[model samples]
Target: MTKTEKTKQFIIEKSSVHFNKIGYLGTSLRDITNLTGLTKGSIYGNFENKEEVAKAAYKYNAKRIGNKIISALNQSPSGAINKLMAIVDFYKNNWSVIIETGGCPLLNAATESDDAFPKLNIEVRKSFIGFTKIFEDIIKNGIEERIFKHDLNIKEYASTMVMLIEGGVLLSKTMADKEYLNISLKRIENLIHNEMKL
Candidate 1:
């Protein structure tokens, strides 16, 4: 990468955790400067302002979480059911890691970005919708392969699945109880096996 790109990337990487752990309004330019050990002008030189950096940091954080699930999906064996289960397994395994980073990025962004950061709130919404697409694709493939019920409501199921997962993460993080998240995921598993599966 070029020097400019590298420096911007450095700022994003350094500030991502800070933004995720704090919020858009909670994090300050000074916090980023402190985290990156860069002067205020240097940070401003790389980013238009703190808002721009926060947006990139949100995306960076979201990508980190998404990549984990994508890796799980890639390593998973064939069968739509197995892929679906692999998603559940990914969440179960990654809960601690996610908790350390101050909960899920999309959730954090959604809660904080509203009213204050309109663009960011939109990005957060897009991120959640993107999550729904993953489940939709999985279910669609399952139905195509005759692995899932033919009559499944793809949109409803996908949206519900994503909502439940996000809710689970929220509850788990807020309550400091992993079981809440596990229970949510277990319910999802049961929903797939009993209702969606053929």
Candidate 2:
């Protein structure tokens, strides 16, 4: 990459976790400068403003988690059921990282964007819709394979899974107990096995 591109990426990488942890309004130019060790002028030279940097950082954070899920889904067995299981296993195994890194980026962004950060609201909503659509696609494929029930509501089921998972993340993080997430995930597994499967 060119020097300008590399510098922009560097700023995004350094400030992403801080944005995820402290949030958009909470994260300041000083924080970015500190994280990136770049002077305000240098940082601004690479981006139009803090909002631009934040948008890029949010994308980076989302992609970080998205890539992991994609990898897990790709590595799973050919069966559609196994793909769903792979998603469950991912959250079960990776909750620590998600927690440590300031919870799920999609959840964090969505929560913070609801009342504030108008610029980010659209991006956050699009990301979540995209995520829910992933589950929908899996269910659609499962139905085609005759592995999942054909009568299921694909959109509702996918949306519920996202809600349940995010709710679990919030509860687990707030309560300092993984059991909350465990319960939620267990419910999802039950739904898949009992409700979704044929």
Candidate 3:
């Protein structure tokens, strides 16, 4: 890549964890410079301002977590049901890692930016909806393939799963109990097995 592109990427990589760990209001341009070991001029040259950098950092963090989920999903060979289980398993195993930087990116952004930053809030909502749709698609496929019960409600199940997961993450972070996160995940698994008879 070009020098400018490389520098921008470097800034994103370095600042992602910091921004995630600290909300946009909490993080500052100085924090980005300190984390990246770049001058304000360099950072500003790469990004228009703190808001621009925050957006990029958030996207970087989301992409990393997304890849992890996708990788776990790919490991299951038993089709959509197993893939769905794998998705849950991934969350169970990596709860700490997923929340280490910023609890849930969508949850963080939604709660923090919703009223303050309309544009970013919209992006966060879209991301959450997109993720729910992934689960919905999986459920639909499973039903079509007879892996999941035909009576299953894909939209409802997907929404419930996402809400539970996000709520669990938030509660766990607030209570400082990783076990709560696992319990929440187990509940989801039980719900899925009981509903789908998997």
Question: Superposing all C-alpha atoms, what RMSD in Å does each candidate have to the true structure?
Answer: 0.8, 0.8, 1.5
Q: Which has the higher lDDT value, candidate number 1 or candidate number 2?
A: 2
lDDT of 2 at 107: 86
lDDT (10s digit) by residue, model 2, range 16-101:
99999999767999999999999999999999999889888999999999999999999999887898889999999999999999
**How do the residues 150-194 of candidate 3 rate in per-residue lDDT, one tens digit apiece?**
888888999988888888898999999887777878888887788
Please report the TM-score between candidate 2 and the true structure: 0.98
Task: Tell me how far the alpha carbon of residue 38 in candidate 3 is from the true structure, in angstroms, after superposition.
Answer: 1.4
- Considering only N, C-alpha and C atoms within 3 Å, which residue pairs clash in candidate 1? none
Backbone Cα, N, C clashes tallied per candidate: 0, 0, 0
Stretches of candidate 2 exceeding 4 Å from the true structure: none
- CA deviation > 4 Å runs, candidate 1: none
* Top candidate when judged by lDDT against the true structure: 2
Candidate 1 on 92-136: residue-level lDDT in tens?
Answer: 998999999889999999999888899899889888888889999
Give candidate 3 misplaced runs (Cα > 4 Å): none
lDDT of each: 0.91, 0.92, 0.83
